[model samples]
Target: MLRTYKFRIEPTKEQREKINETLMYCRWLYNALLEQRITAYKRCGVSLTFYSQKKELPTLKKVCEEYKSVHSQVLQNVVERLDKTYQAFFRRLKQGEK
Candidate 1:
């Protein structure tokens, strides 16, 4: 059996601001990772794997202050989301869907 539920949250102004900031961080991380992957592939025909990127999180945090504000799990999930998207895209390509 399976079940699902949807709920709404009413956060305080401060919480709202934090939520917005997290979303912005997520957007930035996604764009940066995509660009890095594209550049890597173009430069040497190498695609970065999720684990490789995940392992760089500490170094990335040290280099980018904004990343420090977000939770580690949140950032990891962002990387995972991109990986899943790429996986789906390649799977579609193999199926001649694009």
Candidate 2:
């Protein structure tokens, strides 16, 4: 079973803008990487491992920081989940599955 939680924060216009900007950039990077991985696997039956995909993170972190500046750590927190997700995907793939 799983659970969900919800919370709210009051952000100023500038802070809201920064958060949105950071999240958008994070989403773009995550999706592009996923798409690239998918394309690679389609071209070759063997899936590219997350262990390899992670080499891009330092660069991705730079993108996150460049847009939002002070909020980089918060943005990095979200992207980190994508990292773990990719790791799980590779583990499943190696086990002969999705």
Candidate 3:
């Protein structure tokens, strides 16, 4: 059997807004990246790639900085972890691993 773990974070109103913006930005970027890849695939048959995704990362960093301004450490950490996780996922995909 497996166990589940959960955590909670407390943030001020300003921090909360920043965190929300961060989530929105992440979702937007992720969807945009996926759509770009998919469209490329449909056009070129697997020639799609995410290298340009890095170019858009500055937007995420800007949002992170905004959140950090509000001392939203928890949100910042979550964003960092998510960024790392995406990198690992992309790496695994590159390696042909699910």
Best by lDDT: 1
| Residues 7-97 of candidate 3: C-alpha lDDT, one tens digit per residue | 8978999988877876775565456556766687798886433334455455655755643333334434444554566678889999999
Off by over 4 Å in 2: 1-8, 60-98
- Give the Å error, residue 60, model 1: 1.3
lDDT, candidates in the order shown: 0.94, 0.68, 0.59
Between prediction 1 and prediction 3, the one with superior lDDT is 1
Clashing pairs in 2: none
For residues 16-36, write the lDDT of model 2, one tens digit per residue.
897787677767766876787
For model 1, what is the alpha-carbon lDDT of residue 94? 96
Compared with the true structure, what per-residue lDDT tens digits does model 1 show for residues 1-98?
A: 89999999899999999999999999989999999899999999999999988898888889999889999999999999999999999999999997
Best by TM-score: 1
Q: Is candidate 2 or candidate 3 better by lDDT?
A: 2
Better of 2 and 3 by TM-score: 2
Give the candidates in order of TM-score, highest first.
1, 2, 3
- Candidate 1 residues lying further than 4 Å off, grouped into runs, are 1-7
Q: Tell me the deviation in Å of residue 70 in model 3.
A: 13
TM-score result, candidate 1 = 0.90
Q: Evaluate residue 76 in candidate 1 and report its C-alpha lDDT on the 0 to 100 scale.
A: 97
Instruction: Score residue 22 of candidate 3 by CA lDDT.
Output: 69
RMSD in Å for all candidates: 2.3, 6.1, 7.9
